[model samples]
Target: MTLVSQSNEESTCERPTSKYAQYTGVLAATLAAFSIGTYLSWTSSALPLYNKNDTLSVSDQEGSWISSLVPLGAIPITIPAGMLADKFGRKRTIWAITVPLFLCWYIIAFAQSKIWIFLGRFVAGAACGAASVVVPMFTSEIAEQSIRGLLGTIFQLQITAGILFAYATAFTDNLHVIAILCSVAPALLLISFPFVPESPAWLVMQGRKNEANDVLKHFRGAHYRTETELTRLELQASEMREAKASIFDLRKYQKAICITLGLMIFQQLSGVNTLIFYAKKIFDDAGSTLSSSTSSVIVGAVQVVATYCSTILIERAGRKLLLFISVSVMATCMFTLSGYFHFQNSHDLSSVSWIPLLSFAVFIVIFSIGFGPIPWLMVGELFTNNVKSAASAATAICNWTLAFLVTKCFQDMVDLMGISSSFATFGVISLIGTVFVSTVVPETKGRSVEEIQIELYGTQISSIPRETDPEV
Candidate 1:
């Protein structure tokens, strides 16, 4: 009857004394995140080479299609990726991501025609779409509540790191070398991720309680038996009632869905990708003294540093505080940048030549700290386990959809309305996002999935109590 006694399933795997063992799956997922980052930014390097008359000689039309195809390809795959993650297991779906991702890099590395590059970009986009869903869900299900926020943000951090890798590689003259180098990320992930544990929550749902307990023990260490964590997970599984998760079922967690989808929309509408896709052009247009490539590298470096900063501060300052701050600061930065552009367009550029560079640098840092990382991190935290896969997929699709629209329209908006007007439009969206976070989005730091759902439900979700909520 002792809670501490070893079951037959656990006897084969000795319980460890360390807490760090819990993060093995997180570490493995972080590798996949690196690959996602590479997918996102590799184009920055490759596109220039494709434009070379002696190279692929892509027309402007072909170049734009190559760039936009990623999110377009991502749109269709997200829901399927989510379903696969839930049904087959998070670990397996992640393993599958490596194939398409590797193919993406290798195709680009060896491509002689725009057609091959186009197909490569689509495959890369599919892998990114899959990773977007699976990594957060896997990380959420594996992490201890105390460190969940910290671990979840690592996804974004690795993405920043991957982007930086690509930006740095742009210094090399050979585009093929850059693509081949990016290939190393997925190749490493494919080789190493098998060592990571399958999600304990998924195992419990599969009715493999003993195996779940053993995995939980690995994550939580020797003291695991004394905790109610395993029982709570089993109860969560039971409460799900073998319900087949569908996109329609999201209505059950409407508040959670609204906040998640709202954040996704706001995040994209705030024009993060617009700035990223045209960092060099923005610098050149602004007449920066720094080389465009250097400015881009600086932007990438700032993002990586700022994302890591958010990872550290998130668990401490809390999600709501950081998000509010990020949105407010980003809006302010956009308005400032807008003003700079307006002045540059209308007046002498001598007085405020420094403004654009400074504004963009600060903007990248502010973005990396909150708006960049928290939305995706919260996707993993905001839902009940039953709807997690479906909800995450839906939100990711919305994310990619907006990303596509924004990237496609941003240049035209600048051309039609002016750079100042386009940025001003984004500024308005960021301000609205600030209000949304302040009014609707609940703080989720240090809360369990069940606890967060109950808070959102504003009722007894099963027997979990409102008064006993630790994260309140």
Candidate 2:
């Protein structure tokens, strides 16, 4: 990521050359590590109680804060998670979380009491908070400027894939099935710990300047980024040298704090986690006895595939364009499902049954390709290194806080408003999300971090993009 500063050149927006494949491999490992966040919480959907009774006292909707609770649980942990990544190497922070993540799932699998479940979920969510900070920071540091959007999105894409995998195990009553399945992710991630290198930026931060060069050898490909690139990274790290914000502090980076909150709140408003946790029930409402677990699997699979396609297409289409296409499709699907449920009521279930299920499946596909992957990508890239951690924590708070509200209210919403109206309400939210993405978001497709700063904060676009691509 050589910053061609004076001329305002952005990196060549070209796709990765064949050499970036290794970086892509590292991206996969980081993605799997990152996905423990989703996998840990997603298992709540398959709770033995929820599968059968779903009684108010046991698996009741009002009682189900555990699903979204972790994201909220994760809030207090985010700044520390980020600081750890900045202070220690990202791999170290990520590696440290792996054990707790595995154990939390195990406890959830076996826990007999709600107290135990809450504790387990709280712990698991904390691990996710750590991951949310570590993975993107690591990815951004390692990925080519040319492919950052695509690389950045891999985290979300894999998260969708993890959900699909979790839903795939929907049928079994045994907790081990879910536990062992979720455990497999961290187990694999643990293997990458010994092999993958540390974040170059973190190394530079620790004043291991000479050691930073060695790690950079593995992280960067033969097309050496110019000296200016290294200098910019060092300069960014220097700004943070004396800057440390405690978990209790929020005043220093107020703008980042607001944006983080907004990003998380809006991301949840897209109704993604609600749809995921309740995909089966939503299908059931639409007139399909298709086993809630089965519906989950189907939705999960579609999301996984759609996200993969997002990675391939995000660069070609540009971030804003892809987001518009995805949000439009999602909004359409939302309205279609909402109307089907609204009109159908309890009358003649035979008529409106299939549309909601079909609509939901379509919604999953649309979301993954656009809104699902893009939100996290944007949030990760939105903040500069200085406030990135605090911002991520704040956004995470909004994400989980709304997630808790949505998860807790979903069944109540179903009980009060009926399925159709609830879906309609969500559809309207998607339209709002579309509006926000269009007017507020800028094109950061191939921009350097500093260049993005200039564009968003009125600095200036970098020179790389303006300078002709040698490959072209």
Candidate 3:
């Protein structure tokens, strides 16, 4: 199938009258991500309360389960969530996410037993998993190509904001109160998101061309050329439909699948989550002047700020450049941290106690800019409509599974190999990730879906631009 030429399309279309509608819809949909962030990080604060036997007594083993269950719960629902997004539409699947999110908080707020707590964490994880797939898809579809990167990055920004919100609220130390507060994110989404338009791309895919035209007008503003945009979407949808792709057809999408999965693999193996999961312990072990709680808060704040910076820079610096810089600097910080730990094992480290905290803060900042958000953003950018859902599901599963494995094994690696060696290993992996980004990952900045698909498939659509060097 032929694709529309970007230059011709742009020449035909008028500038959007306003971007406020797109911004508002993204804000509304990403509330689910905000809710997921609170759930993912909730254990950092709530697990301590559980262990204290104040509200409900939880054994150390049970606390571990409660903390890990979110990713574990995410695994089972991710594929199904992707399927639902493709079948019912991204907005509907996102709306369905509220059920588990609400149930999660309700169960946690009223729980009298550890089983109830476990169930609560699991369902919260399910919602997190589902949102991971649907939110990016929804945002990507509704966004104009010019600002898609900025909008896609907002998903990660909301997640970081939610994490910081959870960290900030830990001072309350009231499990029920925190649960109730976290529930407000989803509650707001439930109230506001219904007013937002369904994805025009999905509407086009479903052959609802008139509705897609109307929705495009809503997102792009009345002055925008809805017919031109709709025609492009129609061609893409028809091509994908004629391909009739299934899970078995994924072999045809190996390049995208591999690129996406590789990014997810490197994202987890870079040890960002290891640092997040064990931040307090790492801070305490290093004997930082700042309290572990204070350090955790500072790190969370940095993450939010840095991810916000990513949204600003992504459209400017481009994805591959950011990934390369992010991983390279992250590798340096990891090695620096490893040296500190190695020295600590042998020498008094009071004078350089600041090194660990500094290293962690810098590592988190760099990570938030590149490895943390780009992987997810690309999940929405890299694939065609036919295989996008499967690819996203596979990417989410890879990410969560690696997250669980890394988090679970990190302590064991520290015990067996020493903290120094464990961090150095992560450093080596991150160093390798830099090479991967430079060699394999393509830059998606300022590219449309058809342009990206042409690069991935090596199909020469006469109307579409040919792939060029990322540097160019």
lDDT of each: 0.79, 0.66, 0.82
Residue 450 error, candidate 1, Å: 8.7
In terms of lDDT, model 1 sits at 0.79
Error of 2 at 140 (Å): 2.1
Identify the leading candidate in terms of lDDT: 3
Order the candidate numbers by TM-score, best to worst: 3, 1, 2
Give the residue spans of candidate 3 off by over 4 A. Answer: 1-14, 54-60, 222-225, 253-256, 318-321, 342-346, 377-386, 414-418, 435-472
Write down the TM-score of every candidate: 0.84, 0.79, 0.84
Q: Per-residue lDDT for 116-226 in model 3, tens only? A: 988988878888988887898899899998888678778888988888787766778788888988889998988888899899999998889899988988988886877
Clashes in model 1: which pairs?
Answer: none
lDDT of 1 by residue, 123-161 (tens): 888888888878888988888776876787778888889
The true-versus-predicted C-alpha distance at residue 369 of model 1, in Å, is 2.6
Query: Considering only N, C-alpha and C atoms within 3 Å, which residue pairs clash in candidate 3?
Result: none
Please say which candidate is ahead in TM-score: 1 or 2. Answer: 1
Q: lDDT value for candidate 3?
A: 0.82
- Error of model 2, residue 452, in angstroms: 7.7
- Backbone clash count for every predicted candidate, in the order shown: 0, 12, 0
Candidate 1 stretches greater than 4 Å from native: 1-16, 207-233, 243-245, 345-351, 377-385, 442-472
